[model samples]
Target: RGSLDLNLETLSGNLIAQNHSFHVLEKISFELPRVELCPEVLKRAKSFVLADPIFGKPGPIDVLIGNSLFPQLLTNERHSLGANMPSALGTIFGYVIAGTAPCLSTAPRASNLAISLLSTTDTDLHSSLQRFWVQEELPVYDKKSEGELACDKLFETSHTRDSQGRYVVRLPFVDNLAYAKLGTSRPIAAHRFESVERRIHARNSSPLKALYIDFMDEYEALGHMKKPPHLNLSAPHYFLPHHGVVKEHSSTTKLRVVFDASSKTSSGLSLNDVLLTGPKLQNNICDILLHFRLKNLVFSCDIRQMYRQIKIHPDDQRFQLILWRGQPSLPLSTYQLTTVTYGMNCSPYLAIKTLQQLAQDEGSNFPQAAHILKHHSYVDDLIAGASTEAEALELQQQLIELLRLGGFELRKWVSNCPKLLQQLPASHQEPPVFLQPSSDPMFSILGIHWSPVTDCFKYNLNFTSDAPTKRKVLSLIARIYDPCGFLS
Candidate 1:
């Protein structure tokens, strides 16, 4: 059966010879339920038979045997019987029906040889009789009627977000042997570690950008003021509330509101009202520039929920928000912010002022701290830069105090500036040293592991291994067959 010919001509001859034997029985036992035969399949097969009454008759011998005997009944009600039917029966049945019992009596060829041997019981007859059989009869390979191929489906479990705020599709597993050709199998299974590493390494020319930050477009037509205010805030000056949009020098580049500003009335200089003026920005930027130029490194850290730690100004607590039909609404005084919101204009400035005050106080104990960080700077967006590791550490210690005083907690999985990392000779690049905790959970920006003790950062290296990376494996399967590729 392994090498048995499956051609239309060969199958036709066998049917003619078997036709006589088929009529010998009045009603053959099918061993299968009659309902298992699908009307649609039968109708399709019926097209191949001759219109002649004698040729059209499906007699006892014509009854298909084996598992496929009931394939037509692959419906839900009769599936049990059909599912167990032997596969070979379906193949043979399909062949007979497709060949339509060709009239070999007029022109007999290898088909005649096949027909002549159908009734014989000789074991070697198959090989000898097959010598006249045409070996290259084209097969239709019509799987359309066979139904969709059974392949394991990979589903996206969560709404994964990309940098653009679009839901990203994820394929956690690599296409393994299960997806290979019927008999083709591979020795190793794919994982994401290596592929992810290679993708990271390929972008070595530039520093990685923060995943949480993005360039915002401010130039799009501003929404009509008539709709409804999404946020409620109390303000003396027109402080853009957090999450609000503001225009920069250019219409194309709009700066999103990260903080809010307010004036303190009848107050002696409290840190809250010290508007982060142009002088302050210049001072902070200057320190940042100095460290970056000298040390060839600069990094910023964010306090986890920095504003949430600050008590709302007693006079300003009235402004809060209410969610109505999924939209924020209501009076300004009632909307209490649950956490530090990033779009407020004053939050960043206030946060910076607080940090500076805290650093000044902490530096008093260790006078060298202020000197070491003489050029280290920040403006709510905490940047630490230094020519030497010792300088960075001194700054880090001061920043830690600043964080503590401001009541903002530091995340352990945070990252520091790689440019601040101590340069190593080729001889010592493989130790697990730490410089600071990562600010991002995914570590998309750092591109390497940072250790504080050894003060070292190492490039990730899973790209070359057998394991596939999240990004690279995604890219490979993407090239082969991206789901969106079809749609596009």
Candidate 2:
């Protein structure tokens, strides 16, 4: 029928009528399958007529209702069909059996199914707001696990300062016997080194190869990596496989050699597997950003090679060995990483713990800087400020001096006040162009972009013209990166 008013009766003897006239399909050419209801379900739903009049026998479809009429047909009441069986739903037209049922005959038959769509914008918005609140809120203190407590105990008991003022710490092993489980790793390390060399040589230009060599050479020159005096292949040692990573956007080193401590030894155990990953010691990013916004003269700086600043104990250096050769013609040599390597599980904890220890030891000389280091730093990046320009300058000086006491150098300094930055050495500050007011310089604070000239945050949204699917929509939403909820 083109348009009609329909009335339906329920098993409860309630009469329901359509709110308004609605159009319906007059004839459906296809045959609908017969749905056999369970005898027990029918007994429980006594005197209730099936939603479909000819539910138990195959028949040609007479009328079809669209999704717009679902609200009038459906109800919240439901009757379960028991385990592993379809359930019957309470609708205005009586009880409707839903879900899969066995086929009555060997021949295939079509089944009658209704699909309904509802708008979920309100539900999605509510969920999004909840996630935003949880992420932007301050982090709560969590109790340390047994492994973390053990790591802390090891650091407190064995850490010491060298003549150069660098903090030397031992690796936090699971137990005293953890190192004994390690097997020979030199063969695997050699294979991985060959693979890396082949990849670099296959590049179109030789610059990549040269860059890789230069990076390893610098690592050696800085005293971070050294050739072991004695070769003891029988000793319990772990060798890390290394590869090069290129970042063209970086202003300093373009190629960085990354050591893979997760590489397993012959005994099927990795260095990371035996070491205890210490508890997270850095302040949360939300807290750091909140304090950054509280001051009039804000600035940002980060430790240069932060992990390499802390020295590892000599006894643990054998576990951080690597294979390197400047060229294919040169003989391969074994080198031990003396500093806290980045790929190890305990590196972050050791570096951060060292910083806190330094602050506690010398905080009395520079209280403001000490507080900032302890509370305003997120990992290696420092985001702090003061109420005035003079206060900011003094804080900056104190921070530089205090960090120097532990042999930690800060670089990439940027600020809203030009005069404060002017006091810093040209080599120590970020590019001079970032301070020019005519050219608004935007740098990343964590992942969000901020413009020093305008003193405001910026967002670059790159949306695609592709059709909006569930996955694509979610991906686009994730790229927003507004941790501070500035858009809200």
Candidate 3:
């Protein structure tokens, strides 16, 4: 939180954190007043230097030290890394490995790295990254942390295998949410709900109502909610109902119905305030992008409603409650989200973890699809290309089936292969939605526009009446997304 030492480079020409655009920065050095080894032990240290802040702002890492120092700091620390480390520093992280799993390197020696992190990037730029995880396996994960324990609660007894040996998460169905604990139904929570209710009534717009209907329909269809019971024994948790802002999709309006998890009950704790934002999941965006080249027969597809597929554990469903009514004239009804919800802090972890778990569960039967599912996809979007059309088609079929085992569906398929696109029904070949004008004839592959018919990437610009100054032009130019670095 203190002011940062702005000088960030050593004249010796080592890259502290340089991109290829990295010209030799002005040499510099600085000593930290005290790099805390622990609250008890302090090491006055010399760090090479932080680089110029991207966009003139400090990065997540305030200081840059050599990798050699990592082995020493971790080896000498008597307590688990989570303890003793000041909460202000947040936490240390490495990178994503298999299916939405973020890993930290804990071992001191290079030999142990392979065992601990279990994955590596495939190209030249990540060579240094490969070194970060080279050390040995982590010490046992028995380190007690509120975050760790919360994650532990997920794996406790509720997960099992189906007859097909697919891992299935057993979700709890409840007439209502339980709130004896967490002070969920207390007056303060009710007040928060009242505030949301007031806003919806005040707006009273048709588009807003459409969003509400879409949300309630989906909620009921999933069996994650239902009509209020006439009578019930347990005091189900009462979560404040809130309508998400309306988003215009094509011509249709959609509402993201969510419970105000951050709303406090009389207990003064919002659901988010109490929950841990579990371990980071999902591979690096760059890692995912790097693999999506137009090698030969490339294709991409999105996992429909990625988060809704993972069913929350029944024990945990009590935490996801909402209040709502189908008609404004009707009384507000209580409903609980039986499945994982979008707004909850833990949703990403649960969803990604569930995906990774599916890959692990079925990898043996479908190796190629599993590999793409694990390392190649960015969350639900899968980008992969094969050396031949036949190979790509085979990969596509296997991918669809593999995901289906976990109650997931892969749709919105697009490909450079005409045969592949033409062979599929009209639904699969539906023109790229909202990506470009129909006249432009471009298909979007993870934000890059390409001509699937021509098998080449296309770049186009739509001018919005205003001409820009030189600096503005440069800024706009940089906004374009090109992951292959073909321009470079």
Top of the candidates by lDDT: 2
Name the best candidate (by TM-score): 2
Write one digit per residue (lDDT tens) for candidate 3, span 1-488. 01122322232322333331211212222222212122221221111111220111111233444454344323221222233332112112211111111112331221211111222333222332333233122323345566655564654446765564434453222112323434545444444455555455565565665666777787798776654444242554546546576656422225676655666554444566556566666665556655666367888888877777666555556556666666557776666676667766666766777778788878899899999888888777888989988898888888988998887877777787877776577765536643455654666766677676667667766545677776555544555465555554
| Model 2 per-residue lDDT tens digits across residues 410-488 | 9888889988888878777765334346657777787677888777877777778888888666655644678767776
Estimate the TM-score of every prediction.
0.28, 0.70, 0.60
What is the per-residue lDDT of model 1 for residues 1-488, given as tens digits with 9 covering 90 to 100?
11233222122232322222221223445321212333434444443322111222232233433343245422222111123221112232232322222222333232221112123343233433333132222223444221111111221132133342212221111233211111101100011222222332345612221110232111111110111234322232122222324453321223343333221122211123232221122133433433433443334444544444544332233222211111113222212333323543344434444444444545676554444333344433344555565666666666555456445544322224443333323222222333336532222112233333233433433345667666555443333321112213
Clashing pairs in 3: 9-28, 11-27, 100-282, 109-135, 112-135, 112-136, 113-135, 172-314, 177-236, 177-237
**Backbone clash count for every predicted candidate, in the order shown:** 45, 0, 10
By TM-score rank, best first, the candidates go 2, 3, 1
lDDT of each: 0.32, 0.79, 0.55
RMSD of each: 29.2, 19.6, 17.2
lDDT, model 2, position 299: 94
